[model samples]
Structures are given as structure tokens and as C-alpha cells.
Target: MTVIVVLAMIFALLALRLFSVLGRRTGHEQQQIPAPADDRPAGARMPAGEQQDGRTPAQRAAESAVAVPAQAGLRALIAADRSFDVAQFLSGARAAYGMILEAFWKGDRETLKSLCDADVYAAFDAAITERESAGLTLDNKLVRIDTANIVDARVDDGVAHVAVHFEADLSAVTRDSSGAVVAGSLDDAVSTIETWTFSRDLRSRDPNWQLTETDEG
Candidate 1:
């Protein structure tokens, strides 16, 4: 009976020691879990699809364009086309603006036809014809685009339209058929503000947007 009691006491001590070591191990493991990393910064509102700066990638894309007024329309566009990128679209718009201006100045109706809608193309074609009839040619250059911002956007009847306000410096000169400058000078750059609306059919397979309307801003 004494031997049995001694063996039982030894077993109890072993169990207590094992439990003590396990408790220490658990506390040590807890310390390894990073605290500050799991905790969000104070007063930060992190909505879904937003980053630490509190804006989504789409919003950031429109930052150069000041997108507050066009946010609702932009949202509608994004909802319709999941692959649409605002930044990429803005970049493309800038390029198109330059190309269209150059084409119109040089009377390249082919390029204008591809970039503009029927009505827009007709207007440019008429202007080009008039210039050719008058024996006048435009030697215009797009100096630089100062600003390009999406002022409005919407999707209607499966069509998406975005209006962009553009401020640019252009060097324009009109020359006679004999290669003599008739008006304007390349030394002076003219600052012009214009609004161009681009449209695309969401239901169509073609991803290109055409200039649908234009106005002076």
C-alpha cells in the first residue's frame, strides 16, 4: 500500500510538471502573433475595394480628371463592363484627341472617319472640303494637353457615353497653296478648351469608342 501511494504521488508530480510546461508554451506561442499588424490604424475607414488611401483603383484612375462630378456615371460604366479601366480610357482619350486634331488639320478624312461618328465625320469632311476649295491648308500642331477630365458619363440603351473636358495648347497656322503662311504663327501657342463626348455600344463586340459630340467648354 505504501509503494502504491509513492508511485501515485510521483505520477501526480509528472502530470503537474507537464501542464506547467504546456501553459508556458501556449503563452510563448501567443507572443509570436503580431499585434500591430492585425490591428487597423485609428480613424481609418476601409471600405470594400478601397485601399489605405480610401479610394479604389478606379477612383485613383480618375484622380487626374477630378472625377467627383462624374462618379455616378463612372460607377454605371464599371458595373456594365467589368474590364473597363478609367485610367487607361483617359490615356487613350488624350491620344485620340491629338490624332483627330492632326488628321483634321491635314485633311486626312480616313482617320477622322474611323475615330468619329457619322455626324461628326460629316462636319469634319465638310470643313476639309471647304478648306481644300479655298486653297488653304492647316499646318496645326498639338503643343500639349494641359488637362483632360471626365465631366460626365452615363450608360443608356446599352450605350456608354463619357464627356471629357480638355484644355490644350495648339500651334495653328493657315497656309496658301503656294506654301506661304496666310494667318497665325507657330511661335505663339493658342490655348483652347473643348469638351468631347465619346460613345461605345456595350452590347457590341468592338471595344472602340467613337467621338459622338463636341462642344466648346
Candidate 2:
């Protein structure tokens, strides 16, 4: 009878030890594992006040504007053109700068016509014509464009005008009919800076902007 009691007591102690190590639910512990991360698309996960890109609407709007202090003119311009995006505009301007320069040198009038305003196209055409009349040819290549920045923006009478400052490296040579280099260096790269103004009519259906004016700096 004593051995049986001893064995019972030993079993009770062992059970108590196991329970202590394993722990028991006290009706206060977390009952379920956390739900797996939502596998829905990003846009479906959060709908209100958030953009598809995970930013709040206000945050996205702020990012779309130019990274400068609020100018009355620029703000007004944005108000007038609801679809205007400063980042996208600057990117397109950079590409246009290179394209225009190459087209001008190669006498590609059709390309220039599409990119420039009427007056600007006339000026480019006259220069190309004169070069051809003088029996001179220009060999120019855009080595690289270093920077393109928006220096000013404004809207006038439904016309939006923006000025972009461009700094680029180029290799160019103007040669006469005798093949003698008259200007620029073919072997050396030259750094050039120019500010070009682009304009678009808000009332027009065309989404394209045209180069209206240019200034060398």
C-alpha cells in the first residue's frame, strides 16, 4: 500500500512539471495565429486617401509639382493645366533638347518642324538654307546632356510657357566645300549652356509643346 502511494505521488509530481513547462491556457492567451499577409494587389489593399503607388493623394500631388517654393505664377499655371506634371515635362524637355540640336545640324527640317513653333522653325530653316547655299556642312554629335532644369514657368492668356536651362557636351565641326574645318573641333568636346522656352496652348487639343524661343548662356 505504501509503494502504491509513493508511485502515485511520483506520477503527480511529473505531471505538474510537464504542465509548468508546456503552459496551460488561462482563457487570456491569444487564441488564433495572425492572418497571413493580404495577398491582394497593392491597389486593392488600401483604397481610401491612398494612391495606387502607396502614397496618399496629397503626397502624390506634392511630388508631381516642381521642387520649388510656391510661386504664384507656377501655381496658377498648374491650376490652369490640370494635367501638367513637372517631372514628366522636364524629362521630355531633355529629350527634345538633344533631338532638336541633332536635327538642326543634320538639316532635318521635318523633325524640327514638329518640335518648334512656326517662327522657330522658320529661323532653323533659314540657317540650314544659308549653310547649304554657302556650300558648308555641319557635322555635330551630342556627346551627352549633363543637366536640364526648369528655370521659370508661367501662363499667359491660356498659353503656358516654361523655360528650361540645358547644359550639354557636344562634338561638332563645320567644314567648307574644301573639307577645311571652319569652326568647332571634331576631336574635342565642347560644353554649351542654353535656356529654351517651350509653349503650349491650354485651349488646344494637341498635347505636344513647341520650342518658342532660345537664349544662349
Candidate 3:
């Protein structure tokens, strides 16, 4: 009878120890799991209000790179590269749009070469060459960028590509060799919508993105 009582107490102590160990392990596992999905990447620092609720800086920038509800591609991109930020990207894209357009219009091959990939630069070069052959010059100006939004984003094979939809007003003028206006009017700014895709190698240390593709939105 005493042996049976002793065995029962021993089993109770072992069960209590097992339960305590399991509880501690479960809590540790939960801590290892990350918080819910957040659009903001890990590296960049933000102002006080910007980090609230895991919301991205895009929310404050008024242009969400992940789209309003977020897409699978954008999510995948964030997963692949934690440093990607839609807001900063959109800002840089706006500047690049203006710079690339002005360079193409001015026949600034050096600028285009630096900002564009090989294919895009080649296309721009061809157009510039054709224009020069025809003895024409362009005086184009980017009036203002009304909106630039990220429409799509993806990471594939360690390369990241992001598509931005831009709406802007531009004034373009074409002049003949004699410097007489031949085409387009600089007085009238025309609204244009275009989608441009930019790409960067995630593994590369360079943060700059190259213009890869362009199309009418």
C-alpha cells in the first residue's frame, strides 16, 4: 500500500514538471514568431508618428506602394528585401522621371546611360539619333507631376522590379534645323500617363534603380 502511494506521488511530480516545461517552451515559440505583416521595411528610420501601427511611410506620403489593399507581389518583395520602401521609391521615381525625360529631350546620352538599363538606353539612343538625322531639336519641359503611384512590385531570382504609374503635364516643342517651330507647342502643357518599370539587384550594394521598361498607362 505504501509503495503504491509513493508511486502515485512520484507520477504527480513528473507530470507537473512536464507541464511546466511545455508551458515555457510554448511561450518561447510564440516570441520567436514575428508580428503581423507590415509594409515598412526594416532598415530606414522614421519620424515619431510614421511608425505607428506598423503602417508604412507610404501612408504619410499619400502613395501606397503595395496598393491600397496590398498585393501578393508587393508582399513577396517585402519578404525578399526588408529594406524596400514604397514612399522613398516613389519620390526617387518622380525625380528620375523628370531627369530621364529631360535627358532624352536634350539628347543627354550620358544621363540616360546612367539612369537606364541597356535596352531602354538603346531605344532612347535610337530615337535621339533619328531626331538628329532629321535635323530636329526638342525643347521639352516637365511642367509638374500630378501623381506617381506604384502599381506593381515583385522580386524574382534576387532581382526586384517595381512598376509605377505616373500622371504628369509636359510641354514639348520640336524645332527644325533653322530653329523654326515645326511640331508641338510649348505653350500648351499636355497631360500624359505612363507606366515605367524600374529594376535593381537585391544582392548589389548599390541602392540606385535603373529604368528597365516604359509603356503608356
Candidate maximizing TM-score: 1
Q: What is the lDDT of candidate 1?
A: 0.76
Residues 1-217, model 2: lDDT tens digits: 9999999678645533432222122344321111123534545575486544455555444343333542445557667765565555665677678768878998989878978999999999999999999999998899988877667778888998878778899998999999899999978999999989988888987667889999998
The total of clashing pairs for model 1 equals: 0
Over 1-217, each residue of candidate 3 has an lDDT whose tens digit, in order, gives 9999999678645543432221122221211112343645866565565455544453544443336433566657756766554554566677778878988998989878978999999999999999999999998999999988778777889998888889999999999999999999989999999999988887876666888999997
Choose 1 or 2, whichever is better by lDDT.
1
**Ten-residue stretch with the least lDDT total in model 3:** 23-32
Q: Residue 122's C-alpha lDDT in candidate 2?
A: 99
Better of 1 and 2 by TM-score: 1
Structure candidate 3, residue pairs in collision: none
lDDT for model 3, on a 0 to 1 scale? 0.72
Could you tell me which residue pairs clash in candidate 2? none
TM-scores for candidates 1 onward, in order? 0.74, 0.67, 0.72
Where is the poorest 10-residue window by lDDT in model 2? 28-37
- lDDT (Cα, tens digit) per residue for candidate 1, span 1-217: 9999999678645543432221122221211111232365777666788656555666555564745678678767767776566665676788778878978998988878878999999999999999999999998999999999888989999998989899999999999999899999999999999999989888987667888999997
**Candidate 1 least-lDDT 10 residues:** 26-35
Q: How close is each model in CA RMSD to the real structure?
A: 26.8, 27.9, 24.1
Candidate scoring better on lDDT of 1 and 3? 1
